[model samples]
Target: MTHDSTGLRRLLLVVADGVRHDVLADEMDAGRTPALAALRARGSFHAVTSSFPSGTGPAYVPFLMGRHPARVGLPGLRWYDRARSLSWAPAQARSYAGIDIWHVDGDVHADVPTLLDLARPSLAGMSMLGRGAKHGRIGRSVAWMLRAAPSHFRGDLLGWRRVEQQATGAFLSRFAAVRPKVSVLAITSPDKFAHAYGSDSAPVRAAIGDLDAAVAQAQAIAVRDGWRDALHVWVVGDHGHAPVSQHDDLHGWLEAEGLRVLAHPRLHVRDPDVALMVGGNAMAHLYLSPGERTRRWWPTHAARWGATLDALLARPSVDLVATASSATTVEVRHATRGAAVVQRRESPTGPRWSYLTTTGDPLELGDSLHDLDAGTAWEATSATPYPDALVQLSWLATAPRAGDLIVSASPDWDLRARFEPVSHVSTHGALLRPQMLVPLLVDLPVTRPPHRTADVVPSALDLLGISCTTDFDGRSFLRGTPVSAAG
Candidate 1:
């Protein structure tokens, strides 16, 4: 790590995965989470939008690497490489949903650096993406079993109570063991509860309550170690969750459409013409065969897709069907809504985005065309049903490893409708507000709000008095930091 002249004693980054901003806010307001509430009172709290495909592994990228997953060719939970060699093409499909989680470190773009890489001699706990942590490790055998274990067996073996308690204990031990200048701890219970029980259920509330206790324990440890004042702690959520009452087997639906589908555990489904990789059970990547998907996305999918688009759109709960029409453009379609295109143009300052709708707005962004930069685009759409869709979708469609067609489910619906032994009550991964909005907690007094989770890394670096050796999409939102510090 390249440190600035003045450095802090240490830094602690705590990630409570899948904890919703609204849930946190309500808990904090009601005084159930005293530790985080205290931190917010002394610092700043922002309900920021996380990047698209807001699942576990990929969403963590912003906090650790200060960049969107797409920036590193990681489009979250599932995706495949179109450029893979023929021999490796059949093996190119990637899924972080299970035991394959161990491959995350190797899958990202080679040039990108994780937080552990920049901050060496560090330790990571309760995490799957601890690529650079010196002492990080995972039990592959246990993970593999968990992937196929029955719900009842999993319930008895890995209950939320034990998982969270162990997580807190692990955080304390790892922090003491390494005394790292920078580190991270990801709690698994919040996300777990949301999946097992609905997000609005009592169990979910109790999970956040347990998180509050964990935060308290961390603070107590810091103070007891006489490093409270010297420690810069950040408690944040990677992504939020929404209540899911239903499911749709998009993979099976594709197969029923007379198209072959490639999915995990079923990789031998020979000559697969379409790869249906679902993430967070709410969004899916429909990778098409050469004639349909192609290298350059169809210039006008509305014309090229013919009745296929209509058939896909006609599916129940099918919210949005989007494809990259060009390098700088994204064509969006809906069953009953309408059509629109997101285009990027080089501005004098930098790249600018425009929302062009030929008919009814697919995203319902507006009726007329509008052009805006990243900030303004965020401002205009942050509170909409599809938060920050213009900025997020434009970059997502153009991401080097993105799927041919991005499909999002309607409210209360998720894509992974079959194969799972247990059904999820609540989930994420779509561009909806519940999935995109996450609570951010930082101890520093910010000069401005860093509306994106990607800003967490840069902000932490700024507080640690270190200079990032690489450029990042996320910049420090803290006060007294210069623009060039991110690099």
Candidate 2:
């Protein structure tokens, strides 16, 4: 990574997966995490919303490439392309469960450039989305471990912590030799523990302590390896987790309703009319059709799925359902709360968006919102229960990889109940606040931290005086200036 002329010599980012804002905040407030507390003392730390789906795959887009999850067209970790599956190809559906994880780098938009590309001589230690990193890639072997342990409290927790240790160890041993300009280390124990235990459980809290140890080690190593004063560190989370107890058998419920479902472990169904894929158990994608294998253009025909939608919302675990109303609009429905529609349009100022409620407030934003430009829309929904839902949902509603009918599970419940060896006690991958809210710990002080996680990369690039041609949805808020929207 060639930096023109900057005071900072290297940019280091750490992602502690599945960390909740309140939990970490309490950790820092209680003086338990000396390293994080020290970072906060030197820098600024604030709660920010992760992108939609809140799963590791789509959620990583923002931090890696400075693009919204929807803009890249891969909405979730699992997706079924009706256009590809319904035709002779019949191979577009996948769950990226174990060995298939490598396909993610290939599926993202080819034109988009990741930090590994823009910031060369970079290292992705367990940062899974290391498409362009040349030094070394860690954590890909974690997939092999998952096949053995299957991601549970018994063995995978230790394995994930080992991955964290190995990543940090690599930084310690290799930094002096390689001297990578940009390095991103992913600490995965918190996420794994959160999945096995509750988000606020004792085990997950201990995982946070372990993260502190990792941070302390990284700090000492960075200073020792010629980055004492010329290093910028940003510690963040890919997504947050919410506690879960009840499981909604979304796929089973479809099969019981006389629809053929395509599920994992068993990838095919004869003459399938429904394809159900899940992300973090809290969010589900249901592509429903009458044996036509259709996923596109379902938003305009929401009436055809009225009975199914009613039954799903009536299901105890379901929260809200979203569908593409059009290319730039989304139709949303809650079980008992109400219904709403989010729309996008062109305006004199710039492209504007709107959220109007024909019935009750499904999103509970209170009143109907009129035309709002991008910045206002972001500011308006930044604090809602569904953070950034206005623009996030609009972009997701039209995403090619998204479902015709998307479901977000209610609190304390998840959508996957069967066909899995392991069950999660706490999960993310929903539009809810706890799942979407993540902590952004960065050294840069700003009047307002960009509420979106996608802003991190562009902001980092701006810090190092590096420029890229990719049009990022995330804006850089650094050097006391806003990242020009059109730039």
Candidate 3:
């Protein structure tokens, strides 16, 4: 490994999930966050775009790998893999006998190489501290690397605040002793607060304040340790949030439309009375069954039945409509082949009811259509070629195998029904501005200007004075020659 004689440069990444820039600005104006305010004043700050589907899993994957979900093949958190006859959900594993997980679905792939391997060849030591159970794999991998080369690893699998403290302490202790060439510290508290409370809620503000304190601590350590001249600190978020209402009786509406609702027996739905299925934000996937009455008359009155469904969906709470084109099939996207039949009709109801069609089982909706087609005026939906579709409740009544139609409430309206109710008021993941745009602030010892998340990887590489061999979705904004240190 190459070493720099100038001293080591340190990097800190703090991921605050579901925090919006506007909310941060408001808090800063209110004087609730002096630490973040100081960083903003000393460094460059702007909202950088997150990945498609704007959820945590998708956003973090790209933030670490520097690649798009499509390129990495992880389009969303849950995906049905046809080849392996299995479905994949975040932090859950489903086995398909005699089939490789990657081969099951083309979309189940991870495209970019993680920082774990990239940082290995350059740094004197490296460590990764993860706050959530969902990041167990990352923590374990970092531990393994450290075990292999004791001189090159340091990390703790602790909660957000503790992890930040330990990581900052470790960097100070190490810099004072060996003065390693590079180090990274990541904090994950802001995201947790946003998920538990709405973005604008008091709890979120407090979380941001806590994160600011942690950053200030890290900055102090940098100065005291005399590494401030070469250090770089980066604050970024994986994705922002959107407000959504919770529904308790999602299945009740489906039952009213003449559909039988079933349960998974093992995985209990959070809201059993009304909800069949739920997504974090307003997006939901509902299952429908062609009950005795609907099935018997389905072929004869399919058109009229669809019209009735369209009318019911036209209600205030209801959004888009997609009816089944025929028995035994639902179409999630236009090119979504393999089904025996597909939903064909397309209509625009209004700004509220934008996209309408007779499609497939509610649970299988994909990200092919635009959200504006369903009546939303969000810039992310309006500008993108592919807008997310919101499924109507009545459409779930027509599926032969559907458990119940999944329904999504409006942005600020909670569905009073619950089938695994997810209550994040501010959602991001659609190519929308609120979800896609995130802030990147630099507070390193070096005089490098702050930049966006897209510049993260290159910035790290720049600290090491090495040109990246891989092509990145973003660029490096840090300007300076890298300093190397010998172990």
Candidate 4:
């Protein structure tokens, strides 16, 4: 039953969950991290956009699958699964062994093969998809951690951080002997610390320092194992965190507006009333009841839905609201940016979309409709209130599982329902630029700079000399030649 080792030529992807690009950059500039500074000097760095909703689970999709999480109907932090007739809360898993939020087999259920699948005999730490570390080891580690630090095991941030480092380090140490083709270590400290304390808090800053050392530790191990030059290390963040001034009672506001929120699970299949499935702290995904889902009723319902959306947008805390305008188009109404419509169209270069400003600030800064230029159109799509705003919003609009309407909170606010508590002082999962933009660091010059989390794996694959036949949502940016207008 023994398998051959892949030697040391492998990709080591280090996911620093919820670490802000600015925080790390500031620390690196201050000469606090020689390791990161060394990597930056030898490599390239990019401030790429994270996934829409900017939640860890959705953000992980791009890093792991090189595609939008919407393609797989991955509703952020928490959501109700219509297919399963059940609700899920991914970010707040009750046990150390995070539950299968999808409640389905990863390989069979996923839309595309994860990066873990592409590179076999891989080692993953604290990942829900693909093949993570063996259960026996993880279980034993969890048990040992609980017994050793009983008070700190469950909710204590410092305790959890130490245990996570131990578990990941142990796993990596064991896997080093086997030398898998790919290895991923998800450092959850910055994320946990930022959530418990504000992203800019002293504790979070100290945790960032610790994370820098962890990255150095990984690099040192790779070097000692004879994979220093052979190993391609990527120190990246899943999503950036933003400070929140208030947690808006989005559900409460809806109820005050006379909308009945069906928050509980139904015993039978028949629909009762309106449903509000608010997961991902800074966002809300609204779903219709079973009875109201009929096509015949949709035409009339759309108007009512539009009214509701308008009301939500009118709120001071609400940032943006998007709903399907058509099969290939969506209308986004921002609190300050006003309303705009984006339509998917084909150009000579490739598939692109255009925007038209109807009212207020165009959410997007530039005039994309100038001469109807295709390049301009593409560029306009990129220059937005948030990175890749048009495409990400479009995908979410078209996703069948994405609520009938998706709403985001302003930078200073979070969308909190009765069930989903807002404990974090700083949080992601919003359309704001702070949450969406994450740093991408690599040791080689990327011919075409990456723009989103999805682009990471493709760039790595190109470095590994692996040819991908499937049309990935993310294109490789590691080519030697200069990128064309299309890229």
Candidate 5:
């Protein structure tokens, strides 16, 4: 595609949630998604493996910025900040006393340049459509720009198809009359359908069909309006989904293990023995503490607790174990601060576990147990000896502080203390391949192609003819080569 400075290519990014590659291929072969299949025939389509801990927020941010979660400082869906002594969940930022956690400096904006930033003067508009509460931040950012300049404005917050139809109709109506240099549209019906139903559910299939029709309609609008040559339509997804039979209630399990719940007086008044940390689909954090502890009883208690945890892992619901020693890196922040903790181990036998260490700590540093106050500093680490073993156990291991141990369970097994008959029927966030590997499909109208997620940024920059000075870990895949494509 040839372009001028003012007529540079218009990129449209459509995100479908939890749509897997295999599922798409199966659908295509069965003649389910005609629009997507047609696009594939004209260009190319393949499954691009997403980032680890393959959840929505972690996956999509990288695709937009062309970087990894770690590089963007969005390590996972939820992150615990040692300095701030707080646990940050992008999904729940709206509930955080009016604090917009998504805009926090290091979370989503560290090294990433959004498509809006890249489009610059040539950029006509950008839009994001999705269901999560976190998506509000994206809408807010777009609103901020629109308020600054009414003419340089085009955006939408069409969360679902109902809203999407209205918003898209408005966008197309306006753009068709006064065509801008570029206009971006994001459709999210496919992902929403997959989450409520399974990947193969009839409803999900119908949603995909609807989305395909939407794509066709949008393409037709572009073509008729003389914008087809300038428009580059791309369909992508944050992550794919798998059927989940079990879910782990980390909070309930911790409470049963004799941990004392702390109360954040300002946040909530209830005396919570364990804080149930929430992330998208799967994975949670458990913070615990006990009223009293001394150096004399620490080691014996830690070892005994670790053994009990290992025994618990032998259950069908349990899949892996990462002792404080195995899972994370620990660093003591201060003399008064506690020792760091990290530990993890995969289950080798039946109910085999794949213990992948997560990138963030799960506890909030400062909180109160009963009437006693405790340091908020903490870490995730292995169960090895430390210079100050007592402090390390207190900070990292769930046992020393809460009289309970934190456990990470597999998707098949629901970890609950009471073993309720009714719980979550479906879950995600295990260390399994299905849960960890997400799909990415990028359709760029160019001779050169990129294979890996890391390559996406440089490739995008190259498409825009921008200076490639950023030291991205991903390299661009050479164009016009079969091996360079994603599959």
Candidate 6:
């Protein structure tokens, strides 16, 4: 951790997976995390919103690439990439028992480079709960495992405690020894435990306590042996989790309703049946396969798409259904709940959007048709509890590989594929607040109020005194600093 004034500065970023802002606040207030509380006092703490779909992939993509998943070429946790002939899904990683060590189609490099790439010589990523090993030396991971061998041997072989230990080691190695410009340490216990046992369970709280202890250790190492005052630390949650009181077999329902449910995109299909390509626990991508139905009959048979959307909206478990009408327009409908149409429009300042409501609750876009400012769009979505909901979904709905129909499940229920083993007790992947709201705390003096997860990256670049060379959907919260982008 010894360095001269000429080398790259170091930053220690800790991502506490699945821990909600409110939950973290409660923990800090209860004095369960004294060290974390102290850190917050020395810095800024704001409730940041996660990306739309609100799943790990979408959330992580923003933080890493400083862009929305759709813009970065990563759509969701599960999506079919036609160019690569690959599909990102849990079934692909099921054999690993929630550990996907290898990169999948969704794990490709983005159009905009990530913090890992931009911050050269950076040590980033963690391996556990299917998070691919992007970078960082395997030796440190092994050392952490060895250090926690006694606890793993005694009991809790694959528990959050082990994850905390590994995180501690990762922080120590990166901040104290390697001293990279940007070191990302992810603690994935709260998310995993919350899925097994509800988000508000005692076990989840205990996991937070363990994370707090780990944070304490990491901070002590940074101050005692690492970069000390030079190290800028930011702690955040990928996405929040909500208790799922009910499980919806959207795939089963589609099958029972006489629709074919193909888990992934099939290169060739002879049948005329409509199919469903499911994504996360709360969203499904419905599309007609490449066949006579898609090629010839589909153009004249617009009713098929309408009927499918209608049927999906009729489902008691569904909350919202959306699709792209054009390159810049999206229509979002909720059964009897509400409906709205949003379109991207050119503005004197920049590219903005217009929103109009047809009927029902408005779902979040409000009750009138009006133009919206690009800079204030995130705040609008946050107010609606639909973080970047309009733009991101619009990209997916109109994408070349996008499904004909896109659906979001109700908060109380989680949408799942027919073949999934079981539904989680606590889950994410929706526009609702419980899943969208996350914690963002940084030691640096930010210029603006942080609102979105993608803001973290530009802020990081600001902290490193580096200029961004990519077009990021997110802007820096730090004032006067501009992040550049390569066309």
Task: Write the number of the candidate with greater TM-score, choosing between 1 and 4.
Answer: 1
Task: Report the lDDT tens digits of candidate 5 across residue range 394-448.
Answer: 2333322112333334555544322222233333443344544444444534444
Ranked candidates (TM-score, high to low): 2, 1, 4, 6, 5, 3
Highest-scoring model, TM-score: 2
Candidates' C-alpha lDDT: 0.75, 0.76, 0.43, 0.65, 0.43, 0.64
The segments of candidate 3 whose C-alpha lies over 4 angstroms from its true place after superposition are: 1-7, 29-32, 85-111, 121-188, 246-278, 284-410, 413-432, 444-455, 477-487
Off by over 4 Å in 2: 1-8, 85-91, 141-155, 290-295, 299-304, 347-350, 479-487
RMSD of 2: 3.9
Better of 2 and 5 by lDDT: 2
Backbone clashes (count) for model 5: 34
Number of backbone-clashing residue pairs for each candidate, in the order shown: 1, 0, 64, 0, 34, 3
Q: For candidate 1, which ten residues in a row score worst on lDDT? A: 144-153
* TM-score per model over all chains: 0.89, 0.91, 0.55, 0.84, 0.62, 0.83
Ordered from best to worst lDDT, the candidate numbers read 2, 1, 4, 6, 3, 5
Worst 10 residues of 5 by lDDT: 373-382
- Tens digits of per-residue lDDT, candidate 3, 389-412, equal 232221232333222222334335
Better of 1 and 3 by lDDT: 1
Candidate 3, lDDT over the whole model: 0.43
Error of 6 at 222 (Å): 2.4
lDDT of 1 by residue, 1-487 (tens): 1223456547778887888888888888998888888878767788998988888888888888888888777886878767772232345777776656667777776688888887766777666577788755322236533532343335532454564465557667767666677777777667877787876567777777766776677667777886666666687788889888888887777778788888764777767777778888788887767323336565554464556667878888678888887888888888877888889887786667888887778887766556687778888888789888887888787786777788888888898877653568888999888888998987656888778988888877667666877877676787585433322
- After superposing candidate 6, which stretches have Cα over 4 Å from the reference? 1-8, 87-101, 104-106, 127-164, 167-171, 264-280, 290-301, 346-349, 417-423, 481-487
